[model samples]
Each structure stands twice: as structure tokens, then as C-alpha cells.
Target: MAGFLLILSLFIAPLGLSQEKVETIVNKLPERPWAVVEFVRGKVLFNGAKVLKGEKLRVDGSLEVSKRSFVKVKINGWDNTIVLGPRSAMELKLSAQKTGDISPAKYSLVKGACRWVRKKIEGQVEKGLGAVHTPNAAMGVRGTDFYLKVNPLLGETEIIVFDGEVEFTNELEVTDKKSLTSGQWGGVGGRYGQKIGEILNLSKAVLDKFGKKLNI
Candidate 1:
């Protein structure tokens, strides 16, 4: 009887330790932030508190931008940046294991517009991964520059791909998928099921203006 109890205790101890080990890894992930605020203009709030220029943001945290305000965040360990427009709120999910790894982040856009700019790394393609989730659509990032806007009052979501490509899918059903390449713009969440529209050439002035705002 005593021998059997000892054997059982040994087995149970290892199992308990392994379970705690797994939990430790998962808990540490929530503490990691995928991006940090590099520049902030006007009024910006992080987790309902005022955000400093160097504050790190984690997942599930609320980011709010007031009128005439904008925030620029630099993605950790990657040559990419994201800018949030005025009168916008979003829930962030940014975490990564290390630099150059597949770090998938998503911003749940509750309202207003945001832009992502991926600087080209010489001889390297696909350095980072991210997505923008609206009320009705999920926009996938594919190593490119793009903009997403969501109007909660009007129930509209718009996307513009300035460089590379972006794939959009119906958030609820996940069945409808549409791809848009450079110089393309489209909208989702309306009375009709809209798809990607014709490509419109983006002028240099427009690109230059966005570039200047991206204080990366």
C-alpha cells in the first residue's frame, strides 16, 4: 500500500508542474505589447488614461483619439507603423515572441479611421503580420500599406490599399472573401453585399501627405 501511494504521488507531481508551466506561458503573453506609441498629437487616451509618447500598449486595452488628434504606434521589432485618426476608438491585440517572427496583431476598430504603413525592408518580404477588424469585416494585412475606416453611426466600413494587397472577409459569416491590390478601395457593411471596386490611381500628393503624417 505504501509503495503504491509513493508511485502515484510521483506521477501526480510531474503532471501538476507541467500544467503550471503551460499556464505561465499563456499568462506572460497578455503582458506583452505588440506596439508602442512613438508619436501622439493632441488628445490621446490609453486604457482611459492619458498616453505618453513612449507608452507600450497591450491587447484588450482601449485607445481613444479625440477630435483633431492622432496617434502613431511603431510595431515592435518590425519596420511597420500604424496611425490612428481622430475621433476613433480601438481595442488592440499586439504581441510577438521576437523580432522577424510571425507576430500577428489585430486592432478592433470601434470607430473612425486608421492607416498602416509597412516600410520595405531591402530583400525581405513579409516581415510582419496584422489585421483590422471592423463591425462587419475583417481586413487582412499582407505586407503593405492600407487604411481602414469604420463609421458606427452609418454602419459603413471602408478600406484602401495603397501598396501591396489586402483581403477582406465577412466578419460574422467568414464565407465572403475579397482581395484588393494597390490603388484599390472598397467598402463593406451596407444595404447590399458590396465587393471590391475599380482601381483608382492614388496621386503623389496624397501619398506624400500620408507619408508625412506617419511620423515613424
Candidate 2:
């Protein structure tokens, strides 16, 4: 009878813990944030180089990557940028836009920074998501390759286009997307995004890199 009681208590103890665990998780969901930011389905190494998949990121969720830990973002989506000191945080504000299939609202990834590569123009550009905000300016992208950087302490953003082009509008009129190609880049400071310029030549080195199957 003593042995039977021991076994029963063991099971009951775990069951009790499970309920408390569920309650804690449920309580966190609301005070935590409305949604989550799902990273690509791949392996991400932490400070010691370990590939991880299905990272559940909430607002202010952070994953620290040191020199020893390098991350490889695999798979598809509008996920083209990397975060600096990437708190691994999934900003609740952008969670919906990142999770939703389609929308007009834009999403911005601030801090650290990332460079982007655009896929063929097959989706809605306006409702599409693209933009990395930094302290000095913001980098806007549509169907092109661009880089963005943001420092947490400083309030600034900067952008550089490797291929294609971006629209730059600020204190003065900058280049339009219609004038970018290979070996060309641009930078902007201040509240940027919304729209960028275009590359006039489509049959150039930059566009060729994408290897799109022309309907012709």
C-alpha cells in the first residue's frame, strides 16, 4: 500500500505542476502581447552555435548571438533583414503584419540591421512589407536588394541599395527607383519608407541575379 501511494503521488505531483504551468502561460499571453513573430523554419545557433527552428518571439523577445554564434536565416517570406543585438524580440505591433498573409500596412525592423534581396515582383508592392529603420534614416525596399542599419541607443536609420533602386525623399529630392542598376547605391536619413525609386534598366546585372522566368 505504501508503494502504491508513492506512485500515485508521483503522478499527481506532475499533473499539478502541469496545471500551474498552463495557467502561467495563459496569463502571459495577454499581458505579454497580442501575437508572435515566427522566424524562418531553420536552425539558429545561440551564443554557442546551435541551429534552432520555430522560435517563438514576443514583443521585446531577444536572442543573443555572439561572435561564436552565427545565424543563418533560411526559407522564404519578406524576411530579408537582420537585427542588431537582435533582442530576439517580436514587436507586438509588427507581429500581425508579419503574420498576416496580405495587407497595406508596412513593417519595420529596427536596431542592428540587415541587407535585403528582392524576389520577382509577384505580389502587391503597396501592401507588401519592407523597411529597416535606423537612427539616422530608414531603408525602404520593394523588389530590390538593400541594406539597413539602426543603433539602439541612437535614433537613426540608413539604407544602401546594392541592386535595383529605392526612392529617397527628404529635405531634398533624391533619386527615384527608376534610376538604379548594378554598382549603384543610395543613402537616406530621417523618417523614410512608404516608397522608393526604381531602376530604369531591368535587363541588367542586378535583375539578372534574381533569375526570373520572364513571361516572354
Candidate 3:
């Protein structure tokens, strides 16, 4: 009986240690309202504090990327990644209506450019997934990879879609909206007046140019 009990303890000891290792990993993960900074280049700041790679950042404040700088973040509970380009400033007002649902995420791009890429979620339809609000325009995304450049001086927003679909609407005239798909481009405000610009094809050269800029 003593030898049998010793054998049983040997088998159970490793299992107990494995369980504790798993729990420690789970506890190290970032909680809600915080995101992981996956990449950073040049000077990046989150709410006035310098940002570093591999650190968890609270997304409740503003993010600024100085000239010749870039920052990439993965938000918790969201199936997407956001990259802010050089000279960009964005306010992260992100949330979900329900747990594990692709509810709308609200973010404002104050100036410069940003890129949003959504990973396909299994068994999830491509509609009403998220939204990005700029000064003059609002964009509704559906499992898409898109880029936005906000020209604050001219009050214009340029949107380019590389994959999936985006619904663009003028902030001043919500009735004026357009649906754009892959390889298409749209604009709001400035010369577009109270309506969104006519949807146009995105040339390969233009696509490559912006794609490289956003590091997509």
C-alpha cells in the first residue's frame, strides 16, 4: 500500500504543476479597456506617456504618433488591429455592446492617417461590425481592411478600401452616403460638399502607395 501511494503521488504532482502554469499565463493577460502594443516606431505617445512595444496600454485616452513615427495596437475583445501612421492623432473611444459579439466600435481620428484590419470571425456575418468617425465623415466597416487619411486643414477625409466593404457617410449630411468595396475609394467634406464623393476605382499604383505607407 505504501508503494502504491508513492506511485500515485508521482503522477499527480506534474498535473498539479501544469495547472498552476496555465493559471499564471491567464492572469498575465490584459483586462478590458487595455490593449497590447504590438509594434512601435519613432516617437509614439499614449495619453502623454511614451509608449513602448510589448506593453499594455489603456485605450481610454488619446494616442499620438509624431512625425516619422508609427504605432500598432491590438484591442482586447476585438477581432481587429489598428495602426496609426506618422503625424496621426486619434481618440480611442472603443466598446462592445455585448460580450463576444461584433458590435460597433466607436473611434475618432482627429488628424493624419490610420489603418483598420479585421480578421474574419467564424460563423459571423460581414455587416455592422464597427465604425470609425472622423471630423467630416463616418465609416461603417464590415470585416474589412481600410485606411483613412484625415486632412484637418481642409476638413476632408479620404477613405481607401483594400478588402471587404465600407459604408461612408458625410457627418453634416447623413443622408448622403456611399458603399465602397475592395479596390475602391471615397471621400467626404471639402470639395465633396454636403455629400460623399463619387465612389471611384483605386488604381494599382495608388493602392500600392498607400498600402506601403500603412505597412499593410
Candidates' C-alpha lDDT: 0.73, 0.40, 0.79
What TM-score should be assigned to candidate 3?
A: 0.78
RMSD vs true structure, all candidates:
7.5, 11.8, 9.4
Can you write out model 3's per-residue Cα lDDT over 85-159, one digit (the tens) per residue? 999999876554532333345788999999988877889666564578898899885688899999898888999
lDDT of 2 by residue, 48-160 (tens): 34435444333322334443223323223443434222332112133333323432222344445454565545565543354433333444556676554544454444445
TM-score of 1: 0.72
What are the clashing pairs of model 1?
Answer: 34-94
Clashing pairs in 3: none
lDDT of 3: 0.79
**Clash totals in order:** 1, 30, 0
* Number of residue pairs clashing in candidate 3, backbone atoms closer than 3 angstroms, sequence gap of 3 or more or interchain: 0
Q: All candidates' TM-scores?
A: 0.72, 0.42, 0.78
Please name the candidate that would achieve the greatest TM-score relative to the true structure: 3
